[model samples]
Target: MSTTDYLTQGRRVLEIERAALATLEKNLDAQFSQACELMHYCQGRVVVTGMGKSGHIGGKIAATLASTGTPAFFVHPGEASHGDLGMITKQDVVLALSNSGETGEVVSIIPVLKRLNVPLIAMTGRPDSTLATLADVHVCVAVEEEACPLGLAPTASTTATLAMGDALAVSLLHARGFTADDFALSHPGGSLGKRLLLRVADIMHTGARIPMVPTGAITTDALLEMSRKGLGMTSIVDDNNKLLGIFTDGDLRRILDLRTDVHQTPIDQVMTAGCITATADMLAAEALQLMESRKINSLIVVDAQQQVIGAFNMHDILQSGVI
Candidate 1:
C-alpha cells in the first residue's frame, strides 16, 4: 500500500473508534450505575471473563479495576468450566464480555454464574442476546461499524469496551473516596507512589551527618561544618540544640564582600535568622515544592521542641527521586 493509504487507514481507524466511544458515552443508562453499585458492595472480588479479543480487553479492565481500589481479577471464560469456576465464590460479582453477547464459552457459564447466586454484569454489542438477557445488569457498548475496511474486525467494539471499563473503574474509585495516598500504597514501586509517600525523615541527614555549629561559633566554624558535612549549609544551634540561625555559602560570599574576618566574626551576627524549616514528617515532594517556591537550596528539619534534628539540600531530593 502507498504511504498515503497507510495514513488514511490510521486516521479512519482513530475516527471510527472515537465515534464509537462518543456513542457509548451518550448512550450510558441506568444499567451503568447499577453495575457500579453492584461492584462497589461486592464482598468478594470481581471475576471478569470473556473469550477472544473480548478476553484481552476483559483482562485489562480487570487490572484497571484492581489497581483503582476495586478488587478484581480476570478468568478466561473457557477456563471457568474446568475448576476455575471455583475462583468465583457466591459473594463475588461477575463481569462477562462478549461483543455479540453469545460467545459459546461465555454463554455456557451464565447458568453456572446464576446458580452460584452472584450478580452478573454483561458488556455486549447485542443487548438482546442470551448473555445480556441472563445478566443482572447489561451495559450496551454497541458500535455502528468496525474500523476494519471489511467491517468484520473488533476495533471499534473493543475500544468502546475499554472506554466503558475505564468509566466503571473511575466511578467505583470516586465512590470509594480513594485518595492518592491509598493509591501510593498499592503502587509503592512506581514513581508516582514514591512522590506521594516518601517522607522527609526517610531521606533527611540526622545525628553527626547533620551539618551543625554552635551559636557562639565563629563564621569559620560554621564554614568548616558545612564543608565537613558537604551539605553546603550549616545550622547554628544554642546550648539546648535549638536552632538559632543558618549559615550557608551565600552567607560566606557576603562575609567576604564586606571583607569581614571569618575567624573573628560570630556566626550569630552574620547568619540568616529564621530560615525556612521542615518537619521530619513532611512529604519529600512537599519539601521539594517548599524549596522551589521559597527559592532556597536547603532546609533544616526540627522537632516539636524546635531542636535541629536533620538537614538536607536539593541534592538530597534528587538522590531520593522526589524531584
Candidate 2:
C-alpha cells in the first residue's frame, strides 16, 4: 500500500474507535450507576475475569480499581476452573468481560460464581447473552463495529470496554472520596506518591547533620559549621535551640563585598531573620515548591515552638526523587 493509503487506513481505524466511544457515552444509563454502586459497596475485592484481548483490558481495569482505593484483583477464567475459583469469596464482586458474553471459559465459571453467591457485573455487547442475563449488573459495552477493516479483530469493542471500566472506576473513586494522599499511600513507589506523600521529616537532615550555630557565633565559625554540615547555610539559633536567623553562602559573599571582618562580626549581625521554615510533617514536595517560589535553596524545619529540629536543601528533594 502507498504511504497515503496507510495514513488513510490509520485515520479510519481511529475514527471508528472514536465513534465507538462516543456511542458508549450515549448508551450509559442507570446500569452504569448500578455497577458503580455494587463495586462501591463490595465488602471484598473486585475480581475481574475475561479471555484474550478482553482479558488484558480486564487486568488493567482491575489494577486501576485497586490503585484508586478500591480493593480489586484479576483472575483468569481458565485458571479459575483449575482451582483459582477458591479465590472468589461471597464478599467479593465479579466483573466479567466478554464482548460476545459467551466465551466458553468465562461462561463455564458462571455456575460456580452463582454457587458462591458472588455478585456478577458483566461488560458485554450482547445484553441478552448468558453472561449478561446471569449477572447482577450488566454494563453494556457494545460497539457499532470493529476498527479492523475486515471487522474481524477485537478493536473498537475492547476500547469501549476499557473506557467503560475507567468511567466505573472514576465514579466509584469520587463516590468514596478517595483523595490524592490516599492514592499516594497505595502507590508509594510511584512518582505521584513521592510528590504527594513524602514528608520533610522523611528526607531532611536531623540532629548533628543539620547545619546550625549559636546566635552570637562569629561569621567565620558559622561558615565553618555550614561547610562541615555541607548544606550551603547555617541556622543561627538561641541557647534553647529556637531558630533566630539563617546565614547562607550568598550572605557571606555580600558581607565580603563590604570587607566585613568575618572573625569579629557576630553571625546574627549578618543573618537573615524571619526566614522561611518548614515543619517535619510538611510534605517534601511542598518544601520544594516553597524553595522554587522564594528562590531559596534551603529551609530550616522547626517544631511547634519554632525550634530548629531539621534542615533540608534542594539537593535533598532531588535525591529523594520528590522533584
Candidate 3:
C-alpha cells in the first residue's frame, strides 16, 4: 500500500473512535450519576475487575481514581475466581468491565461478588447481557461500529469505555472536594508536588551559611562576606540580629559610580534598606515569583520579628528542582 493509503486508513480509524466518544457522551444517563455517588460514598476501596482489553482499560481507570482522591485498585477477574476474590468486602464497591457482557471469567465471579454483598457496577456495550443485568448499576459504553475495517477489533468500543471511566473518576474527584494540596500529597515525587508543597525553609540557607554584615560594617567587609557566601549579596543586620538593609552587586556598582572609599564607607549608608524579603514558610515557587517580578536575584528570609533567619537566590530554586 502507498503511504497516502496508510494515512487515510489511520485518519478513518480516529474519526470512527471520535464518533464513538460523542455517542458515549450523548448516551450518558442517571446511571452514571448513581455510579459516581456509589464510589463517592464507598467506605472501602473501589475494586476494579475485568478481562482482556477491558482489563487494560480498567487498570488505567483504577490508577486515575486512586490519584484523584478515590482509593481504588484493579484485580483480574480470572484471578478473582481463584483466590483474589478474598480481597473483596461488603463495604467495597466493585467496578466490572466486559465489552460483550458475557466474558466467562467476569460472569463467573458475579456470584462471589453478590455473596460478599458488594455493590457491582458494570461497563458493557450490551445492556441486556448477563453482566449488565446482574450489576447494581450499568454504564452503557455501546458503540455503533468498530474502527477496524474488518469490524472485529475492539478499537472504538474500548476508547468509549475508557472515556466513560475517566468521566466517572473526575466527577467523583470534584464531589470529594479534592484540592491541589491533596493531589500534591499523592504525587510528592513529581514536579507539581514540589511546586505546591516545597517551602523556602526547606531549601534556603540559614545561620552561618546566610551571608550577613553588621549595620556599621565597612563596604569592604560586606564585600568579603558576599564573596565568602557566593550569593552576590550580604544582608545588613542591627545589634540584636534584626534585618536593617541589604547590600548587593547593584549597590557596589552605585558606590563605585559615586567614587566612595570602600574601606571607610559604612554599608548602611550605601545599602538598599527595607528590600524585598520572604518568610521561611512561603512556597519556593512564590519566592521565584517575587524574584522574577522585582527583577532581583536574591531575597532575605525574615521572621515575625523582622530578623534575617535565612537567605535564598534563583540558583537555590534551580538546585532544589522547585523551579
Candidate 4:
C-alpha cells in the first residue's frame, strides 16, 4: 500500500472507534448506574475477568478502577477456572468482558460466581449472549462495525468497552469525593505526585539560605545578598523580620536607567513593594501558577504577620519536579 493508503486506513480505524464511543455514550442508561452502584457498594474488591483481547481491556479497566478510589484487580478467566476462582468472594463484585459474551472460559465461571453469591457485571457487544444474560447487571458496549476491514478483529468493540469502563471508574471517583490529595497519596513516587503533593515549605529556602536584607539596607547590600544566595532576588524585611518589599535584578536595571547610585540608594526606596507572597502550606503547583499569572520568577514565603520565613524561584520549583 502507498503512504496515502496507509494514512487513509489509519483514519478509517480512528473514525470507526470514535463512532463506537459515541454509540456507547448515547446508549448509556440505568444499567450503567446499576453497575456503578454494585461496585461502589461492594465490600470486597472488584474482580475483573476476560479472555484474549477482552482480557487486555479488562486489565486496564481494573487498573483504572483501582487508581480512582475503587479497589479492583483482574483475574484471567482461564486461570480462574483452573483455581483463581478462589480469589472471588461473596462480598466482591465480578466484571467480565467478552465481545460475544459467550467465551467458554468466562462462561464456565458463572456457576462458581453464582455459588459464591458474588454480583456479576458483564460488558459485551451482544445483550442476549450467555454472559450478558447471566450477569446481574449488563452494560452493552455494542458497536455498528469493527475498525478492522476484515471485520475479524475486536477493534471498535474493545475501544467502546474501555470507554465504558472509564465512565464507570470516573463516576465512582466523583461519587466517593476523591480529591487530588487523595490521588497523590496513592501516586507518591513520580513527578505527578510531586506536582500534586509538594508544598512551598518543602522546597523553599529557609533561614540564612533565604536572600534577605534589612529595611534600611543599601541596594548594594540587596545585590550582594542576591549574589550570595543565587536566587536572583532579595527580600526586604523590617527589624521584626516582617517583609517590607523585594529588590530583584529587574529593579536594579530600572535604577541603573535612572543613573542611581547602588551604594547610596536605600533598597526600600527602589524596591518593588506590595509584591505577591505565598504561604508555607500552599502547594508548590499553586505557587507555580501564581508566578506564571503575575509574570514573576520568585516568591517570598511569609507568615500571617507578613514575616519573611522562606523564599524560592522558578528554578527551584522546576528542580523540585513540581512544575
Candidate 5:
C-alpha cells in the first residue's frame, strides 16, 4: 500500500476504536456498579480468566486491580480446569471474559464455579450469550465494529473490554480509599514507586554524613568540608546549629575571581546567605523540583526549630534512583 493509504488505514482503525470506546461509556449502566460492588466486597482475590486475546487483556486487568488495592490474579481457563480451579474459593470472585461469551474452555468451568459458591462476573460483547446468563453480574463491553479492516480480529472489542476493566479497578480503588503509599507498596522497585514513597529523610545525608561549618569558620574550612563530604556544598550554621548560609564550589570560584584569600576570609564573607532550605519530611521528588526550579544543586534540611539537621544534593537523589 502507498504511504497515504497506510496513514488513512491507521487513522481509520483509531477512529473505529475511539467510537467503540464512546459507545462503551454510554452503555455503562447498573451492571457496572454491581460488578464494582461485588469486587469491592470480595473477601478473597479476584480470579480473572479468559481464552486468547481476552486472556491477554484479562492479565493486564488483573495486574491493575492488584496494584490498585484489589486483590486479584489471572488464571488461564484451560489451566483452571486441570487444577487451578481449586485456587478459587467460596470467598473469591471469578471474572470471566470472552467477546462472544461462548469460549468452550471458559464455559466448561461455570458449573464448577457455582458448586464452589464463587460469584461470577462476566464481560462479553453479547449480553444474551450463555456466559452472561450464568454470571452473577454481567458487564456489557459491546462494541459496534472491530478496528481491524478484516472485521475478524479482536480490536475495538478488546479495547472496550480493557477500558471497562480499568473503570472497575479504579472504582474499587477509590472505594477502598487506596493511597499513593498503598500503591507504592505494590510497586516498590519501579522508578514511579520511588518517586511516590521516597522522602528527603530517607536519602538525605545526616549525622556525620552531613558537612557543616560554623559561622565564624574560614572559607577554607567550608572548602575542606565540601571536599570531605563530596556533596559540592556545605552548611554554615550558628553555635546552636541553626542554618546561617551555604558555601558551594560555585561560591569559591566566584570568590577566587575576586582574588579573595580563602584562608584569611571568614566563611560568612563569601557564603550565600539565607539560602533555600527543605525539611526532612519533604518528598525527595519535591526537593528535586525545587532544585530544578531554583537552579540550585543542593538544599539544607532543618528541623522545626530551624537547626540544620540534614542536607542533600541532586546526586543523592540520582544515586537513590528516585528520578
Candidate 6:
C-alpha cells in the first residue's frame, strides 16, 4: 500500500479501538462494581487467567492490579489445569478473560474454582457465553468489530479488555486509598519512585561534608569552604550554628567590580542574606523545584531552629537519579 493508504488504515484501526473502549465504558454497570468489590476485599491474591491474546492482556492486568494495591498475579489457564490451579486459594479471587467467553482451557478451570469456593470474575465479549454464566460477576467487554480488515484478529476486543482491566485497577486503587508513597514502595528502582520517595536528607551532604562558615568568618574563609566542599556555595551560620546567610560563586563575581578585599570583608557583609532554604525532611524533587524556581543551583538544609544541618546541589539530585 502507498503511504496514504497505510496512514488511512492505521487511523481506521485506532478509531475502531477507540469506539470499542467507549462501548465498554457505557456498558459498565453494577457487575463492574461487584467485580471490584470482590477483588478489593479479597484476602489473598487476585489470580488472573486466560488463553492466547487474552492471556497477554491478563498478565498486564495482573501486574497493574499488583502495583496498584491489589495483590494479584497471572496464571496461564493451560498451566492451571496441569498444576498451577493449586496457586488459587479459597481466599483468592479469580479473574478470567476470554473474548468469546468459551476458551476451552479457561472454561475447564471453572469447576475447580467453584469447588474451592473462589469468587470468579469473568471479562468477555459475549455476556451469554459459558464463562459469564458460571462467573460470580460478569463484565462485558464486547466490541462492535475487530480493527483488522478481515475481522479475524483480536484487535478492538483486546483493547477493550485492557481498558476494562485498567478501569478496574484504578477503581480499586481509589477504593483502597492508595497513595503515591505506596506506589513508590512497589517501584523503588524506577525514576518516579526515586522522585516520590527520596528526601533531601537522603541525598544532601551532611555533617562535615556540608560547606559552612561562621557569621564572622571572612569572604576568603567562605571561599575556602566552598572549594573544599565543591558545592559552589557556602552556608554562613552564627556561633549557635543557625543559618545567617549564604555566599555563592555568583556573589564573588558580583563583588569583583568593587574590588572588595575577600580577605578583609566579613562573610556576612557580602553574603546573600534571607536566602531560600529547605528542610531535611522535604522531598528531593520539591527541593529541585525550589532550585529551578529560584534559579539557583544549591540549597542549604536547615532544622526547625533554622540551624544548618545539611546542604545539596543540583548534581547531588542528578546523581541520586531523582530526575
lDDT of 6 by residue, 1-323 (tens): 99999999999999999999888878899999999999999999999999999999999999999999999999999999899988888999999999999999999999999999999999999999999999999999999999998988899999999999999999999999999999999999889899999999999999999999988898888888999999999999888999999999999999887899988999878999999999988999999999999999999999999999999999999999999
Whole-model lDDT per candidate: 0.94, 0.94, 0.94, 0.94, 0.94, 0.94
The sequence of per-residue lDDT tens digits that candidate 5 reaches over residues 255-316 is 99999999899998888998999998888999999999999998899999989999889989
Give the poorly placed runs of model 1, Cα more than 4 Å off: 1-3
* Candidate 4 lDDT, 141-234, residue by residue in tens: 9999999889998899999999999999999999999998988888999988999999999999998899999989988988999999999999
Model 2: clashing residue pairs?
Answer: none
CA lDDT of 126 in candidate 5? Answer: 96
The lDDT, on a scale of 0 to 1, for candidate 4 is: 0.94
Evaluate model 2: give its TM-score.
0.95
- Residue pairs clashing in model 1 are none
Question: What local lDDT does model 6 show for residue 214?
Answer: 85
RMSD of 2: 1.6
Q: List the residue pairs that clash in candidate 6.
A: none
Worst 10 residues of 2 by lDDT: 184-193
lDDT (Cα, 0-100) at 312 in candidate 6? 90
| Alpha-carbon TM-score of each model against the true structure | 0.95, 0.95, 0.93, 0.95, 0.96, 0.99
Best by TM-score: 6
Per-residue lDDT for 58-168 in model 3, tens only?
999999999999999999999998899998889999999999999999999998888888999999999999999999999999999999889887899999989999999
Off by over 4 Å in 6: none
Query: Over the stretch 1-323, how does candidate 2's per-residue lDDT look in tens digits?
Result: 99999999999999999999999999999989999989999999999999999999999999999999889999999999999999999999999999999999999999988888889999999999999999998999999899987888999999999999999999999999999989999988978889999999999999899999997888999989998999999899998999999999899999999999998999989999999999999988889999999999999999999999999899999999987
Q: Model 4, which residues run further than 4 Å from truth?
A: none
Error of 5 at 310 (Å): 1.8
Model 6: how far residue 84 lies from native, Å = 0.7
* Predicted candidate 1 versus true structure: per-residue lDDT over 1-323, tens digit per residue: 99999999899999989999899989999999999999999999999999999999999999999999999999998888898998989999999999999899999988888788899999999999999999999999999999998988799999999999999999999999988888888888867888999999999999989999898898888888899999889999999999988998888898899999999999999999988999999999999999999998999999999999999999999998766
For model 1, what is the C-alpha lDDT against the true structure?
0.94
